[model samples]
Target chain A: MNCFKALLLLLLCTSLPAVEPVKLTDDGRMKFTPVFVDGDTRLTFVDFENPKVFRLKSMDWKTREVKVVHEAAPAPEFDPAYSIDGNYFSFLRTTGGLQVSLVIRNRKSNEEVVIAPEPGFSGYRTPAIAPDSSQMLFSFANNFGQDIFRIDMKGEGRTALTGTKGINIWPSYSPDGKKIVFTSTRDGNYELYEMKPDGSEIKRLTDSPYQDIRGQYSPDGKQIAFVSHRDGNAEIYLCNADGTSVRRVTNHEERDDYPTWHPDGNHLVYVAERDGSHDLYLLPLKD
Target chain B: MLNIGSFKTKTCSGIGRRSFLQMSGAIPFGLGMSGLGMVTADEVDHVVAKAKSIVFVFLWGAPSHLDTCDPKPNSNSDYRGPFGVIPTRTPGVHFTELLPKLAQRSDKYTLIRSHIQSAPGHPDGGTVALSGFEENPKPVKPNFGSIIARHRGFRGKLPPFFSIANGVVMDGGRRIEAYGGGEMGAVYDPFMVGASETGKVNIPALALMDDVNPLRITDRRQLLQQLDSVPRTLEKSKFRDWNRTYQQAYGLITDPTARQAFDLTQESVKTRQRYGQSVFGQSALLARRLVEAEVPYIQLNYSRHVEAITPGYEFGWDTHLYNFSLLQDQHCPIFDRAFSAFLDDIYARGLIDDTLIVCMGEFGRTPKINVRAARDHWPQCYFSMWAGAGLQTGRVIGESDKNGEHPITRPITPLMVGTTIAELAGVDSQARAEMRVLDGGRVINELL
Candidate 1:
C-alpha cells in the first residue's frame, strides 16, 4: 500500500511535462507565504527548496508587473522584515552554513545590498528597521541568551541597545518612533515590555503564564496588540501601553496573534490558526 | 607562528629531546657549533603549472564513500553499505541522496574511488593521503602543502597554506611526517584558522570589515613586535626553529587582502543560508573566500565541539562501528547540503575553472560489516578525489570490486598525488634536486 502511494505520488509528479525555465513574475502572492505589499509594487519573499529571496515588482492596477530585481542566487530569500518607510528592508541569508550579515532592500531602486558583519562578528540576527528607517534593531546571542541591538542606518556596524541577559525579540518601534515594544523571557515566561529607544524605561504590558510575544504598538502609541497563550490556547490580546485596559479581543481556543496595525487604528490584522493551519485574519477595533 | 595561547603539555622528557635541543644537537659539538640542521639542503625543483592554488576540502573522520558517495545500490544491501545513491548531472555517476546539491553538479568533479594506501590508523591514513608517501623506516617527509609552502611562502599575503579540519590532512601523531613537516623546516606547516569553539570566532589575525582601515592592524603588529616579548614553544628539533620562523611570517597579518579572505560576512545572507547553518558549511564557504584571496591551501575542519558531535556532528564524521546507524541520522545531512552548495557556488561563480578541489577521507571502510553492524577501518584500498587545476573533470577515475573492496581498473599510489600537487605548485618532483627530502620518498606520478 505504501509502495502504491509512493508510485501514485511519483506518477502524478512525473506525468507533467518537463519543466521549462520558469521566469516567474505574476504568481506574486503564492511566491511568498506572506506577500508584503508596498504601493503599486507588490512584493513577495519566497523560500525555494534552496535559499530564501525577496522579489520586487511594479504592478499595474491589474497587478501585472515585471520582475524588477532579485538578490543573488541560492534562490528565494526568507524572513524579510521591512521598515515603516518603504525605503529600506532587511532579511537574513545563509549559504553553506556561514551566517555572515543582515540585508537591507530598497524598493525605490531595485537593488539588494548586504550590510554584512566581518568574519568572526558575533550574536546578530533578524534586523528590523525603525519607522524613520534610519537606524535598525536586531538580536544578538552571547554568553547571555539574546539581547537587542541597534545599528546605524548607513550600516556602519551595530550598537547594543538592550544590554541584558535574556531573549529579547520582535523589537517594534512605536509609530511616534520613540518607544520599542518587544517580548522577553526575563520576567520568566514570555511577556511584553516597552522601553525608550535607548532601552531606558521599563513598563510591563502583559502578565501571562504562557508565552505572549510579537508585540506591536498602535498608530496612536496608546495600545499594543500581541499574541498570547494565557488561556490554554494561543490568542491575540490587546492592552494599554502602560499594562492597563487588558482585553481579550478574540476567543475561540485558537492561536490568533502576530497582529499588525493598518496605519489607521480602527482595523488590525493578525495570523490565526482556526482548524490547524495559520492564515491572516482581521478584527475591527472597538475604538 | 607566535605559538602564544597555543595549548601545550608539561615537559617530562618523554621520548626525543625538546625540538630546540635537537636543533642545537644538529651541530657537531667537537667540530664547533654549526648552523641549524643542514642535512644537505637542496632546492627541490619540478615543472610548474598555472594552477598555483588548490582548495582541499578534507572530509575529516573518514567519511564513507560507499554510503555517502560511490554508491552501488545493485549489490546486496550489506555489501552496498547503506544510504541509497541518487542521479547526478554526470551521467553514469550517482551520489547519495544526502548530497542533492552536489549530485546535480557531479560533472564538475573527478572522483577517484580506487585509492590504495597502507595506513589504516588516522595518522597513517592522513600521512599517505596528503604527502602521497608511506611512513618509511627512516626520515619522514613533509606534507604536499608544506612542501609547496617551503617553496616560497604563500603566493599571496595570507598564510601560503591553511587547514580547516583534520581530514586525511593531519598526522595521526605516531606519524607526524604525514601532516607535519617532518624533515623539512616548520616554515612549511599549514596555518590553521577558526580554532575558537564559539561559532562567533575572531580570525585572530585577519580583519574582515571593509572599513577596517588596515593601518590600525599594522600599527598594532608593530607595537606587539617591538614592545611585547614573543616566546617560542621549546622544541629541540630543527623543525621546531623552522616553526618559529614560520610564525614570524604570520607578521604579514598586516595584509588587508589576507584578512579579507577570512571575512565571511562580506558574502550575502542568501549565500550563507545556502550552505546551511553548520560548521562544515561555513568552513567550505570560508575556503572559497580564502582561495579567491589566493591562499594556496585551506583545510575546513568539521568541528568536534562535543556539543553536537555524533548526532548532528556539530561536525564530527567518524563512522566506523556506527557507520550506518549514526551516519544516516546524523552525519550525511550536513555534509550533503554544505558540499552540494559549495560545489554549486564554485561552478556558478566560475571559480571551478581555476580551483582544484580534492574531497576524500583517509581510507575506505571494510567492505563487510562487523558484528556491531558497522564497517571497520580497511586501509588496504579506498578512494581519493581529483578535480579542477587542469586535470580532466566529469567522471570517476577508477572502479572498485563488487564488495567495494579493491580497484578493478587503474590503481593509484601516493607518488602520483605528490607529483600532481608539485605540478600545481610549480615544483618538479622528477627533478633530481626536488628528490632531496625523499632521500628518496615515493612520489605519486599518476595524479598529475
Candidate 2:
C-alpha cells in the first residue's frame, strides 16, 4: 500500500499534516488481524477459527475475502510481520521447540522461502521483519536478561541489540528504519526505550513505576501508540516520537492491550477482554 | 524562608529513581541548616541576592553554521548555499538572515562564533556540551546543571533545575540521561516539564489542597504507620527519612501550588499568543514562569525526537539533505521567532538581569551542503550566543572562517563555556566547573 494511503486511513486518527499515516487496505473480510504483505493493499491475519472444526482460518485483505493465503499455519502465533515490499510474511513457527520461520511466498511467482528449514530455537518467537526484510528481530535469553536479537535473514550473523541485564522485549522498528523502540524492565518497571538500529545513543521514552509495554510506532514514526498501565489499566497511549503529547486512546472497562496500528494508521487491532473472553477486536480509528 | 513558620511536610511521589524526594533536617538543595531556629525575620524576607538562574535553550541537532551563524558570501554556491549575509550592529561582524532577531539584539549577549568539540554525532555532541567532557572513553559524567542542583538548592518548592519541551530520548543508552546526573545520583536531575496530550507541564503527579487538614491525615496515617512499626516515635531514622520523603510526596500528590507553576492559565490568552501557541514557544513561556518560581535552570529542546521523525517535526539539529529546506521553510522560522520572543520577553520582565540564557546545540551543521543539500554534523566549528546574568556580553568572543567551517580566532572549549556559566551563577567558577566533568577547568577568562 502507498505510505500516504495507509497513513491517510491512519490520518483520520492524527489529522496533523506533518504525520501522514502509512496506508493499509480496507478489504471487506471483516479484516482484523492485519499483517502487511506490502503497501496498504496486501494484508493477512488469522481469522474465523471454526469452533466445530477447531482449525485456524486465514484471510487476505487484498482479495477482500476469506482466501487461502496460507493453509496450515499453527497456533500460539499471530501478527506476521511482512517485508517492506510485503512479498513475504514471517511469523513464529512452533515445531517441537519454538522457532520463528519466515514463510517467504512471492505473490508473483507464488514461490515461498522458509528461513527455518528445520526445528529449533525454543525461545526465538514473535519474529519482527526489518523493513528491508533482510534481518529479523526477536526475543532470546542468555547471561543477559531476556533481550531482543536481530539475525540476518541470509543466516550471516545474529546480533543482540538490547544486551541489558533487565528484560527487553517487543522490539519494533520505526518506518524510517533509523531507530528501534522496545520495552525494557530496567529501573524496576517496564518503560519504553528507543535507539539506533546499531544500538547507539539509546534514549528512554517513558518513566513510570507501572508496566509500560507493547509499544509500536505509527508507520510515519511521528507518533508511537503503545499500551501502558499508567492510568490504572492497560490503555492505549499515543505520543510523539520525542515522547511528548502522550494521550490515552482506549478507555473501556474491558482489558485493552496488544495494539498494532493499521499500515494507514486509521485503524488498529487489539486483544480486548470483553464478555470474559479474550478475542481479537478491530478498533476503527476515527482517521 | 524563616524556620519559625517552616514546619516540614511529608513525602511526594513513590515513583522509582528521582521521584523519591528526601526532605529532613538537611535543608533540600543541601543548603546547610547551621543556626537552627535562630534565623531572624529580616533574613527570611530578604530577597535572594543571587542572580544565578539558568535558561538553557537546547537546540536540537547541530545547526548549519554556513547558513545561520557564519555565512560565506564569497564562497561557491554549493558551499554558501542561498542565504545572503547581513551586517550586525558591531562593526566588522555579520550573521545570516536566519538570525535576524538575534542579530538585532546581539548586543545583549556574547557570541562564541567559533567553539569546537570533537564529536560530530548527536549523543556525543550532547554529552560533550552537557557534561563539558568528550563523549569518548567514559560511561558517564555529571552535567553542569546537575552539579548546581547538588551544590546549591532551589529557592522555593520548585525543582532546583528544570527542562522544558524535552521528553525526547537521545544517544545516552539507559535511563533518562538527557537531563541527567550520571553517577552523582538521580536526585540532582532536573524536573521535566513539557507538552503531553493532557497539556500538563510535568506529568501531573497526585496533588493535595493547600488548606487540606494535613494534621488529621498525618495523625491518622502516622498512627497507622506506628501500628506497623516497633519504635514509638517512628521518627529520626533511615526508615523515617524514607517515610518523610514519602509523606511530602503524598502532600505533593494533592498540593495546588506545585501544579499551579505548570498552569498555562496563569498567562493571559494574549501572552500565550505572543509566545507562539506551538509547543516550542509555549514551552519557552512556561520556562520563564518556572524561573519566576525560582527554578534555577531550564532546557528547551527545540526538536521533538532524535530522528527526522515524522514530518515537520525535527528533534535534534542533525540536518542532512532535507535539512536546508526544513531550516528555510520550517525550522529557522520557529527558532528565530521563538528565541527573539523569549530573549525580549525575559529582558522586558527584568528576569534577564538574573537569569542567564545560553543558546546552542551539541555541534554545528556541516559547512558544506551534502548530497541531499542538507548539512551533516560538524564538530570542528560552531557558534553559540549567551546573555543575561553577570557573564560578559555584547562581544563576539570567537571567530570561524568565511564559510563558518573552522575557528579562525579564540576556539573556546566546552569546559570554558561551562566555567563561564559557573561564574555567572556566583558559584566559584573554578570550583563548580571542577564539579562538572570538565573538572579543573577555569572559567573562560578572556570574555570576562
Candidate 3:
C-alpha cells in the first residue's frame, strides 16, 4: 500500500502543471529568510531542521537538488544579497552569538572577508549591495541605537548614512543605485523611509500604527514589498515606490514574513507558516 | 478521607464549655487547636518552624556562576570573559560589575558557590534542582512545595502554594516535572498563576469567568445544591480531590482579603516603580503579597523561554551566543534591579527572619567561555544565594576552583536544599518518613 501511494504521488507531481504559491520544502522543518536569484531559478534560504544549527541552504527546483551554502555555522546569518552577476554575495554574520558583522564572500575562490567589524556596537543587519557592486549599505548598532552605514567593497572607508536616534534598519538599494530605501522607528513606530545614497533629502514613505519592517525594492524599481503586523499577524504587503496604493499580498492566518522579490518582478518568494511547519512559498502578484 | 479533620468519640468525651475555654486560653502556647478545631501533631510543633513562607526565585535558564556570584578575575581571559570584578560588602567576596546591586547588598544574603546539579540539560537539571531527583521514566518525585502543601494541609482561604509564571518551563518536548504535585498527585499541586507580558496577573483555571463573580455569588443555595449533586462514583474517584480546590477558588473570588493578595493595584506607584515595570519585577511584587498572605511556597520563574534568544517574546539565561551582550543589555539589569528591590521590600516589612528566599537556577553556565562567546551548561559547580530564615548572612559557603569548574570543599546537592527547606518549614523527619517523600534527604547543616 505504501509503495502504491508513493507511485501515485510521483505520478501526480509529474502530471500537474506548475502552480503559484508552490511550496519548495517538504522537510517538515522551518525554512525561512529566503532570497531569490538566477532569474528566480535558484533560491537561498535559512533552514531550521535543527533549531540550534541554522544552515544557509539553496535549492534548484528545476534540477530537484539542494545544497548548503554555509556549513556547520550555528549563529543566524541575515539579509543575503546577490550581486548583479550572482558571482559574489554579501550578508550579515553574527558571531559570539550576538555580535553582528558584514561578510563578503566569493563562492568560487572560497575566500571570505569581514567588513565593517562591530567594535563597540552590537552588530549590523539587512545588507544591500549597490547596483554597480562598488559599495554596501547596512544598519549598524551602538549604545545610542541603530543607524545605517555604507562601506566600500574593499571593507574600507565606512561612512554613516543615517544618524537617527531610534532604530533604522533593513536598508535596500534601488535599482538605479542613486537611492536607498529602508525602515525606521524615529517617529516611535517602524515605518518605511527613502533617502538618497548619500543620506540627503530623507522622506518618510509609510505611516501606520503597525510595525513595517524588512522593506525591499522590486527588481523593476516600481514597487516595494515589506512585512507588516498591522492586520493582527505578520503578512506580506506591497505599495508603490512612493508609499501609496497599499494592498495586502498574502493573507494566511499564520505568519507570512521576509518577502524577497524575484528577478522576474512578477512573482516573489516568502516564508509562510502553514499546518505548524514553516516553508518557502512562491506567490505571483495579482494585478 | 471525608472525616480527615473530624474527631471520633472513641478518643475522648465531648468537651464541656469550661474545658473548651481552658483549651482556647492555651492557644497562645502550642495547644495545637487550629481555628477549625482540628489538631495534628505537626501543628503541636509549629513553633519550631524557622520560616513561615518561602520565595523560590528560579532563574529558568542557568546564569553563569563565574559571571555573577563566583567571579574568577584571577583566571585567564577565557575564564574571566569581558567584565571586570568588583568587591562586595563582604571582606573577601566579589561579583561581576554587571551585578552592582547584588554586590552592594551581598551582606543581606549567603552565597553558596559549590551548589551542584545532577544533569546539564534544561529538563533534567530543572527536575533535579527543584525535586532533588534524577530524570526517570517512572513516577516523578514531588517538589518541596508540594510536600509542604501535603504536610501543612489546608491553611486558610488561599491555596498553600503558588507557581508564578506565564506558563510552565518548557524545553522542546520536555518540561520541568517539579512544576506540579508530581507523584503525590495533583491535589497537592501548587496553584499556578500567570503574569502576562504586560504585567497582569491571571489564573488559568479561573479563565471561564463568564458570569461568575467571586464577590457576588447570586445564588448560594443553588451553587451548594449543584455541588452536592456530584455522582457517587465521581465523589469516590480522583475527581473528589477537586472539592478542596473548588472551595479555595470560591473563597479566593468572594473574600476581599484573598483577592487583595493577588492584586498589584493596591501597591503605591512609587512601590511598584521600585520593583521596576517589567513582568518579572511585577511577579516578584505579587510574590511579596503572597508572602504577606502567609502562603507557604511561591516559585517565581524568570522567563519560560529556555533556549533561543528571542527578545520581547521570552527571556531565559541560555546564552549560546553574545552571552556578554545579553547579560549586560538585558538579563542582569532586570534581575539586579528587581531582586534588590525584593530584598529591600522584604527587609522593610520585617519578613526577613520569617521568610526564606532562595535564588538559583537549574544549573550554572560553563566556566570557560566557548567559541560562541557564550557559556554552555555546566552542572559541576554553580551558585545559590540563600537569604532570610535566620541563615548566617554576609558569608560564602563552599568554594569553586580557580577556574570555577568544581568544588574545592563539600558540594551541596538539590536533595540537601529540599531537605533544608522542608526542615525549616516545620516538616520534621518523622513526617517526611510517614509521607514516604525525601526518604533519605539530608539537610545542609551549614546553611543553618
Task: Point to the candidate with the largest lDDT.
Answer: 3
lDDT of 3 by residue, B222-314 (tens): 556545664445545466456656677666766678888876767775676566545576788889999999999998888763222332223
RMSD of each: 21.0, 19.1, 21.4
- Encode model 2's per-residue lDDT on A1-287: one tens digit a residue: 69988887765553332332222222211112345455655445643232101122344555544455445644333446666776555564433222334444445576655555233222343457777766767665444245577877554477878764455667788887888888775554467889888777778998864557777888888888787756544567788888876766777543566677778876766655332223445566564
The models' CA-based lDDT, in order, is 0.55, 0.57, 0.71
What's the DockQ for every one of the candidates? Answer: 0.01, 0.02, 0.02
Among all windows of 10 consecutive residues in model 2 chain A, the one with the lowest summed lDDT is A23-32
Q: Which residues of candidate 1, in runs, are more than 4 Å off?
A: A1-287, B1-48, B136-138, B166-177, B195-222, B225-227, B231-252, B303-315, B430-432, B435-448
Ranking by lDDT: 3, 2, 1
Off by over 4 Å in 2: A1-287, B1-50, B166-168, B171-178, B196-200, B204-254, B306-314, B429-437
lDDT of 3 by residue, A1-287 (tens): 99999998766432322345877665534455688766567787866543233467888958747888777665656557777666668876656434567798766786787864544324556678888888888776553446788888766778888874456777888888878888876664567899999998889998775567778889889899998766645688888899887677777655677888878787778887553345677787643
**Consecutive 10-residue window with the lowest summed lDDT within model 2 chain B:** B2-11
DockQ of candidate 2 relative to the true structure: 0.02
- Candidate 3 residue A272 Cα shift, in angstroms, is 36
Residue A209 of model 1 has an lDDT of 49
- How far in Å is the alpha carbon of A227 misplaced in model 1? 32
